[model samples]
Target: MISINNLTFNIGARALYDEANWHIKPGEKIGLIGANGTGKTTLLRLIVGDYTPSSGSISKAKDLKIGYLNQDLLSYQSDKSIVRVAMEAFARQNQLHTEIEEILEKLETEYSDELITRLTDRQQEFEQLDGYNIEYRAHEILAGLGFSEEDQKRQLNTFSGGWRMRVMLAKILLQQPDILLLDEPTNHLDLPSIKWLETYLGNFEGAVVIVSHDRWFLDRVIKKTVESRKGKLTPYAGNYTFYLEEKGIRETIQRGEFKNQQAKIKQEERLIERFRAKASKAKMAQSRIKMLEKMDRVDDVDDDNPEVNFSFRFTKQSGRHVVNIEHLNKSYPGVPILHQADGIIEKGDKIALIGANGRGKSTLLKIIAGTETFDGKVEAGHNVTMTFFSQHQLEALTLENTILEELQSFAPTYSETNLRSLLGSFLFTGDDVFKKIKVLSGGEKSRVALAKALTADANFLILDEPTNHLDIQSVNILIQALQQYEGTFIIVSHDRYFLDNIANRIWFIEEQKIKDYPGTYQEYEVWNSKRVIPKPAPIPVKQEEKAKKEEPRPVMQNAAQQLKKLNDELSRTEREVETLEKQVKEIETELADEQVYSEPARLTAANKRYQEAKAALDLAQQRWEELAAGIMEIEEK
Candidate 1:
């Protein structure tokens, strides 16, 4: 447990935190949320002793261990394999293992009673520490974080920054520290890896404080919410959703109180104005003025959520078919991205392109934007104008130009006044538009690039991870902008909440083909959770003949009879699969419940039932597939 008492931190003259207090209790899951530049990460660092507060103190329980994960870990590089790197978390176990090995080698040559005793002691400690299973635990965590077995064996330096960040996260999870301070932990994680981490943290015994822009993740994992704003920390008793509702209620009450106080002050002033000139009433008026001055004024609520007033304009409306792809084939070296993948983006189609990392989501986006080389045709529809937005575009911004200048150059048709107004909506108000691009942070630069991308006279938008560095408010503004736009767009983002609000269709790549789900991301998730695995490919002629020799085929009176029998069996199997699937879902829901997960016996029972139901579902699906395949064969004949 950690207690931050009257913590005041300042960066030069600006107080990032002024008497901000938060008590992180054991086993509590807290989400630290605020808009950009509100010092969420700085608070985490303050708690971890990386930065000392200007005043007050951050006191921690004696011998408490803390693990901090931040974006800086993305630069970590090592020649060692990822598994070896992750195993470094178990320092004591590794040391004991080394010592025990040395003792065994010594006994091979110079055996003695003292050496044997020492070996026994070390072996006992090693067994107690579970040293033998450390490597296996490390591998399990790495796999959960999205590393393949082969990837685990590869050197860490071979991976990109995002992948390297995942390695650092794996190492931290392996450590299992008493307190986890994660700053945007989901920034580099894919949907599957994020889900895995959510499950892992849900069952984590220690306390956790997370700073993230991901609302869906926070809603799923965090039990408490804390907002950092206006040099103060405000606590909410529940998750983000609860915080929003509670904050709204508080704001309404505050507004009422503010109105009542203002009315009282006005009435007092009117009385004073009417009677102050009379010598007899001067003292009473002066007394009332003093009381008014001493009254604590309730501050009005801050407008963190800004409305999007700017609308996208295009030179010409795009044709009904915005983009058409035909047999799209793209690959790199040994990695095949899309093979004969085909998809169409019609007018007003807001597609959320998503999948696990290394699934070529970005590659597909670039291909559609006409920026990447591919083997097949990716043709733009008639009268279509396009604009592409990616993180790489942030680097394309001219450092010497001011934010306003950058936008002006990008959209010459728009006047300076309109550009400034547009910039204001992106959180650059007053003199902020005059700041040089070089002085901006990564998030600021991303906003500038996004502003340019959105302001373009293009009907088709290709946005790849636009919500990467945006805060929740900024993402909401984007959602608003996209909602108002009639143009078609395909966006690649891991932010589920953002996607669910903006996308009307979900697009993902599976088996190297573009797959489209005609619904929102939330609906796609439900469908995907129950999607059945496809049957295996047909055997070759030689293998089929060998199988025929090894096994006897069932004889039927006629093809019609065989078809009817297979159809009937398939129908029965389908019903069984559905029942088994429902049973599995029920068990999974129970396992997800806090009461069941927190109780060992209940958890064990639920897990057992889940496994049994899953096995039955798999068997039923296999039979269904076989029956359907048999029906297909007979019908073909």
Candidate 2:
């Protein structure tokens, strides 16, 4: 329950918002999306009262509690344990608890009736607020966000910046505010933690407003989409998928209307020019001129943002087996991350290596990339040139070198124009190429690293969380570029949507073993969901028959029980198949629409969805068939 009426905010000469009216209702989940520097975060700050609007007002219920998680971690007590820091979320409850304890100590020393009454009142208030469970709740949130029990007792300063951000997130979640405002909450989280957050938010009773670049997370968590663009807020009534569909329709219609107006204006101007001097048509020509002057020109839709367009160029082709690992084992000190891991990477395989944090997904990638040593046989095939990109690779850049010089060092044969053009593709244009690496932000350094990797004529690319610092548009660009490349690559990423688009195979690492699934991430998920948990060893046939005879079959389904269970499963599988088929049809219809074909991103996304849905539908049908056969077998029995 927050409302903004005619909200206007400005930063220097730019109007971030002008007369913007938006209402966030109770229990609503909204996603804020836009290009980089489009004031998404600024709007969040304004709503949270950190920044005053230039004009208009933001209103909220007087009792509404807002928890805002900013991109930057807040200053915290370095010496305090993470659990203690998180417990501070319920400061009032903790204070009451402390006061109640003090009152009890006073009662032991012949306290007055007033002290007893105060203690009783404080205890009632604490119970009313569920304050007694505050410590348990804090630990639960910390564990869900990936802090081990030992980590909870560790000082906050011992954690890295990313983990510190996670601690802040845990604190916010523990507060359980009426409205949660998160900006890039998933930026620092691994896949497992992100999924945990998704489940937590799915069950949260309060309203949520998040700004994120993780499309899959947004699609799963948010019910509404709000775009901040050109000093206005546009709302979509559905999730990110529906938002994309509706946005495509609106842009297509807008472009058509603008084109029609331009055509009519051109025709009117031509007629006026031809009839200007005619005695009989002078009045008509003058009237047309006045009409032209009064007509508001239709501005062209602004959709032509510069897109990144470079592809990986290979100097030579690699053998069929690009990388082969056997009995790989790696450990650090007392921790063993991977053991007896074996896998093969073909020359043209695009593999997505995924797992929970500290489970050795990145370690496996490093081992395969030959950047790390291990106790296993890790071999590369003939002519397999590798280029690796990691956060550490960004740190390895020479801080004294300019962006242009960095690329030049990587490829000394490239001309200045070639270097500048390549840098421009990654959003470093003109004088930006001359900026020293020392002054670059993390995102800038990431882009430079990506650009360098792309320019290298490597046949096999090993990238770890390549899209961590990229915006949605840049990520799409990279996806498109990678889709067209003929090189083999192993990518470690938590972005499910990105993996869906690029990964042809899934290497899921669990319990120190690599399980290879020959499908996309979505397919892998469906398969994983359908995996049969090992059942306890069956009792002897005589015992089972004796128990069955002794147990009365009270008026129940009886003989049809097994059949009924199979029928229910069959029905569910059939329904899933139907839903996926429907999605495929809808995406196909959109792809067929002439308007959507004009936007490459929309077309690409639609096509990708169509393929994925078709694949899922096929899997569902197979599952349905299996269930039907099982039911028939049970009926015969």
In lDDT terms, which candidate is top? 1
Tens-digit lDDT track for model 1 on 198-270? 9999999999999999999999999999999988999999999999999999999998898898899899999
User: 1-637 in candidate 2: lDDT tens per residue?
Assistant: 8989999998898888999889999999999998777789999999988999999999999899999999766555478998898888998898987887676565555546586468559867987887756777787788778776566887787666777788899889888899999999988788768998999999999999999989999999999999888888999999988998999899889899899999999999999989998999999999999999999887788863455445456779999999888898886554555689888999889999886665567778878877777998999999999999988888789999999999999987677887787677676877999999999998899999988888888989999999987777777877877898899999998899999999999997755568899999999988876543221111111111222211212332344765676788888888898898889789879977877654444644664576467656765776687788877765665
Residue pairs with colliding backbones in model 1 are: none
Where does model 2 exceed 4 Å of error? 74-77, 279-283, 304-308, 400-405, 412-425, 429-434, 532-637
Per-residue error for 302 in candidate 1, Å, reads: 1.8
Give the local distance difference test score of model 2: 0.81
Q: Per-prediction TM-score, please?
A: 0.83, 0.80
Number of clashes in every candidate structure? Answer: 0, 0
Q: How well does candidate 1 match the true structure in TM-score terms?
A: 0.83
Candidate 1 backbone overlaps, count: 0
Clashing pairs in 2: none
Report the number of the highest-TM-score candidate.
Answer: 1
Off by over 4 Å in 1: 533-637
